[model samples]
Target: MLCVRKSYALPTIILICLTYFLFANLPPGAESPSVNERTESPDTPDQANDGRLHFTKKSEKYPVSEYIPLPTAAPSPIPQIQYDFPPESWWGRRQRVKRQKAVKEAFTHAWNGYRKHAWMHDELSPLSGDTRETFAGWAATLVDSLDSLVIMGLMDEFEEALKAIEHIDFSTTHATQINIFETNIRYLGGFLGAYDLTNGTYPILLKKATEVADFVYASFDTRNRMPQSRWEWTRSAEGLGIEPSRNTILAELGSLNLEFTRMTQLTKDPKYFDAIQRIADEMEDAQKKTRVPGLWPLFVNAQDMSFPDPRFSVGGMADSAYEYLPKEHMLLGAQTKQYRKMYDAAMDPIKKRLLFRAMTRDGKEVYFPGNIQATLSPGRETLEPQVEHLKCFLGGTVGIGAKVFDRPDELSIARKLTDGCIWGYDIMPTGIMPEIMYISPCKHLESCPWEEKKWYKDVRDRLAKGAQLEDLTGMAKSLIQKHGLPPGVTQIADAQYKLRPEAIESVFIMYRITGDQELQDAAWRMFRNIEKMTRTEFAHAAIDDVRDPHTEQLDYMESFWLAETLKYFYLIFSEPDLVSLDEYVLNTEAHPFRRPTAA
Candidate 1:
């Protein structure tokens, strides 16, 4: 789950008075510790050891001096074939029908569990048959799962959730500072998606969505127009003019355009569009000044709008910024070249700086995406190449961006990265990739990949002696020793899988684009593994570690497990005509938004 800073539970009047007192005395350009700065909590030992189950995981700052620079040799691109709409005839209509039904059944089981044990709560802890309130007491899982319910043709459940939406009072304020980005994507996006799915028949959904958006809009009252990462709705904005502290998260600002911009079209209110447009422009402008094009530092100063350093990764804090680029262009009907231009500019740097091909112990070469901790020095030496499973979402994002922008090179890069992610799953004991891994970017090592390398043990011995290993704490030493690695060259930095859907989300998009049967099969295998491992008496619970899949269950069921993972699984198996990608673009939360008509 995404970590958020929370305000102490205080009476509404006292909280409002405190806010007024704090911000009232601040001078122009004087920084106050805003929610954005406080929002980033250091990784707890558990998070560092076993990664969280969400894409919005913790962001860590690595020193600039600890990286291997990118190889001067050109990256070998994966070949791409022209994608035909109807992929293949191997899976007959009957098989597809069966697969879809099975997905629905699984969803039904999970949903029924939620209703039975943890109805009207943020999420279900299937292990304890209890509910947890992470967000406002608004039944987040049900709301997030709205469009998926309709897509699966679960009319009874859809209606049940619909009635619940009618009674949801978004006007309520709480001690927990609502994370505007998450609330917008999962809840507001969910509402808008369900409304569109139902042909806008449910105006109450729209009304509730607007209420939430309106309540959060106060956070954008800053002079720089960046929204504070979190806000207490209890405090009135009448006298408070405190902007985000010196630092604001890129993902929080960059990911807002789709949801809020769509709201503008729906309600015909420019406030929503105007608020995000300025930030979008800032993102585009920041690219021009960045050392690596299309990549922005994780944090930027809210007052000066200056990015502090050159640390870049398509995970956690920076994940959604790149995701929104092509999406923004598509959502705006490709009329605006700005988003496409930003996306294009970013890809060259991304591929050059972040792509790596590593050979495992068995002499099989695998390509993977890695983060670049860049430096601004004239001869910048530090360029760490590491991978987070969350970054795997780039596979699908890049694929979609390639298709929309007609960039074959981008598609090729996507193919390589997606294959790498699948490789992670293929080699895992439970057939699920861990949250984070590090790939060996050891290029042209003298003793590695010699012509005499015939056995797995030989490669393993060479790598163990030659390549710098990633698992400094020996978490994956046993696997490394046993597997004798390069083609399967991966160190599980964080072994937990918090029911994340990025890899599967990529599989869905890949199948849709390439009509690759293997991708579909991969999705099926993943779904089955997830179902088998996560099953509890009431509902599925997230596991503490994917390595020990069934040993222990984390007492939490994140909303996204229902919203994105199963939804993508269902869509991949269902008929292509069910939810046409051409007709809609799914937000980060898997909520489908109708594409806007060409302006």
Candidate 2:
């Protein structure tokens, strides 16, 4: 049976305020259209306006113009030297084919487990053989894995999944509320990605994608048109008023551009694109006003479009928001320039402020991106040395941004960052990167020698400040004797491995961009380690700790384990031209969206 949580009831006072805000803020000529009336725009030519006012009067303030099919400008051609692949003979084409098949087999094992144990649920608990609904009980794993199946040529599985998708009613869900960001990327993005890959041969894919997108689009029906990042569809369905959350994270509100724009492209309804574009406009205005000039804060107030928190990171709370900039530019075939402008603005500070080199025991010069806690005073921001496995995706985002925008220097940084994530995997006991850890950063970007005494002292100081004496002693002993942690790793903040795809995601991008055979070899080692450590009788499971080879297996398996992690692993070994970076731009979820043709 599917899990159903009780809905959150809105406070009466807040509801009254929202009602007045909606009516009072209506533009002079704009009728405050009901949510149902605002759901669809009239069908019209690509460039022609539908002769409707879709937004509040404040919509005129949007920095980006409305949807119009502009003639795509030819992108600057990539230099041939940028792509230096190992010749087919050098890598042995037969061996590559075998590896690709192995990855497919791994995917199939996981998929079959989901089918047998948790078919219509969000995830499979591989160990205990239970079903879990992390998202709405909508077969998230099935929908999320759709494109992966198509990419791997699992036509039989794809057809089976499509049969199930045909019956999914997006209008209602067991869960009272859904994460707007996760739903958009996994379900909506999944449908569109599969549609593109199959060249619309399956109209059901687009039909389903449109259905999911419409459900998502309704969340943007606020006075300001900014979406409630976590939307309560049940309340909206109940005819209770809904408003955007006063507190929301950057990625939640900002990462919808790629998926929403693609929806508009396919349906010729500007409503989807218009909703996200309004977000972009507000973000553009907010970018320069942030404590860090180029970057936006992690937490935002969607109600008034304010940045309440001054913390910034290229990591969790703020990752995909920045990631989508260059991707959105490529998806539009370089027709949109604001995305490029935003990309440049953010990358400048990210290179200087967030990215740092780690001083390793072997004196290897590798870079990792970190976080910043900003103060109102200039030049007083605190740099947090903690890094998340999720941040590893930055390596790929940067590499692709470099290629798309013709920034060669950033590509070099991309290589070092990719290597850093690989080092993270190689250093751990299970040969898989942990969810999060703290590192001793080097003062210099290019070179930093390992100083044993300094590293020990820094670790001791950090432990002494917050830890109990016995706790500090135990941690010190464990760091030296039990954990056998690599130098420069101050602490394993989160030891669990969640079967994340970010590290491999970067490796795949590096291979595609540079044709680096070394990356392929590194990825193979990662896959072997992951398979050995996490494989269960049923399917793969996330482990308790990456530092223990015999760690207990956790019950839950994320959808990305198959949708992204294995998909990237398979593509790394498959033919280079398959899902070519030049042809398609992948969403944060690793679903590949076909790019518009460059003129």
Tens-digit lDDT string for candidate 2 (314-370): 889789998899888887777667888999999989988888998899987789998
Top candidate on lDDT is: 2
Best by TM-score: 2
Off by over 4 Å in 2: 1-87, 466-479, 482-484
Instruction: Assess the local accuracy of residue 254 in candidate 1 as a C-alpha lDDT between 0 and 100.
Output: 85
Residue range 1-599, candidate 1, lDDT tens digits: 22232466457755565445334433223365557533433232221233321112122221122322211233222223224556536657677778778888888888998988888888888888888888767789989999999999988888888888787656553334567788888899999888877879889878878877776776676666667666533222222233564666778778988888778768876777777777877778888687666678777776678887667777878888889898877777665577878988888777766667655555544556666666656225444546677877888888888888878666666766787787777776677777876665546322346232223332344335455446432524554655433243444557777888888888888788888778888887888888888888887877766665455777888999889989999999887766667767789998988875442
TM-score of 2: 0.87
lDDT of each: 0.70, 0.81
Question: Model 2 lDDT vs. the true structure?
Answer: 0.81
TM-scores of the candidates are: 0.81, 0.87
Question: Can you tell me which runs of candidate 1 are displaced by over 4 Å?
Answer: 1-84, 87-91, 237-239, 361-365, 442-487
Model 1 lDDT-worst window of ten: 54-63
- Please list all clashing residue pairs in model 1, or write none if there are none: 53-498, 359-486, 360-485, 360-486, 360-487, 361-485, 361-486
